[model samples]
Target: MKVVVQRSKQASVTVEGRVTGEISFGLVVLVGITHEDTIQDVQFLAEKVAHLRIFEDEEGKMNRSLVDVGGEVLSISQFTLYGDCRKGRRPNFMQAAKPDEAKMLYEAFNEALRAKGIKVETGVFGAMMDVKLTNHGPVTLIIESKEN
Candidate 1:
């Protein structure tokens, strides 16, 4: 499991010219699932995302987690995170999980975040989505369950 976490002032996802999900003053999470991902990966990533201290406190220090700031989450499925570009000009996606399995894990990951009392929104899985966001501090971080 891999995730690109970005702090945002606001974010939204549009599919086929229709807004599917949106959030204000929160975190925008781009999630990816690989063949080896399991329930443990989902659990670990969800917990880490929720407790990540990217939001700034009163002293202008990044000391507050999403829970402390009462922020929302906009989760989007992005299998391309696993794209392997080491070879020729084209990238290979052999490491990405199949749609069926990936969707199941993706839903579970979002549900896990919701269980933590955070308002979670999501883009349609397997759909071509246009994501828009006002990145706060342009703060972005890549987290991988396998690596940790």
Candidate 2:
């Protein structure tokens, strides 16, 4: 499992011209699942994301977690995170899990975040989505379950 976490002032996901999910202040999480991903991976990443101390505190230090700030999450399934581009012009997506398996893990990830008492919104799985966000501090991080 891999995730790109971006702090945002506001964010929204649109599918077919209809807004599907929106958040005023939170993180935009782009999630990717590989064949080896399981519920354990989902749980780990969700916990990490919820408690990540990227948000700034009163002293202007990045010391507050999402929970402390009462922020939301706009989660989106993004298989392209695993795209292997080392071979040629076309990126290879063989590393990405199949849709059925990927979707299952993705949903579990969102649920895990919600279980942490954080408001979690999501884009439609397998749908073409347009995500808009005002990236707060442009603070972004890439987290992978395999790394930790």
lDDT of 2 at 99: 99
- State the lDDT of candidate 2 residue by residue for 1-148, as single tens digits: 9999999999999999999999999999999999999899999999999999999999999999999999999999999999999988999999899999999999999999999899999999999999999999989999999963
Task: Extract clashing residue pairs from model 2.
Answer: none
lDDT of 2 at 52: 98
After superposing candidate 2 on the true structure, give the runs of residues whose Cα lies further than 4 Å from its correct spot: none
Q: What digit string (tens of lDDT, one per residue) describes model 1 on residues 1-148?
A: 9999999999999999999999998999999999999999999999999999988999999999999999999999999999999999999999999999999999999999999999999999999999999999989999999974
Instruction: Give the RMSD in angstroms, all C-alphas superposed, for model 1.
Output: 0.9
List candidate 1 stretches off by more than 4 Å.
Answer: none
* Cα lDDT, all candidates: 0.96, 0.96
Clashes per candidate, residues 3 or more apart or on different chains: 0, 0
Weakest 10 consecutive residues, lDDT, candidate 1? 139-148
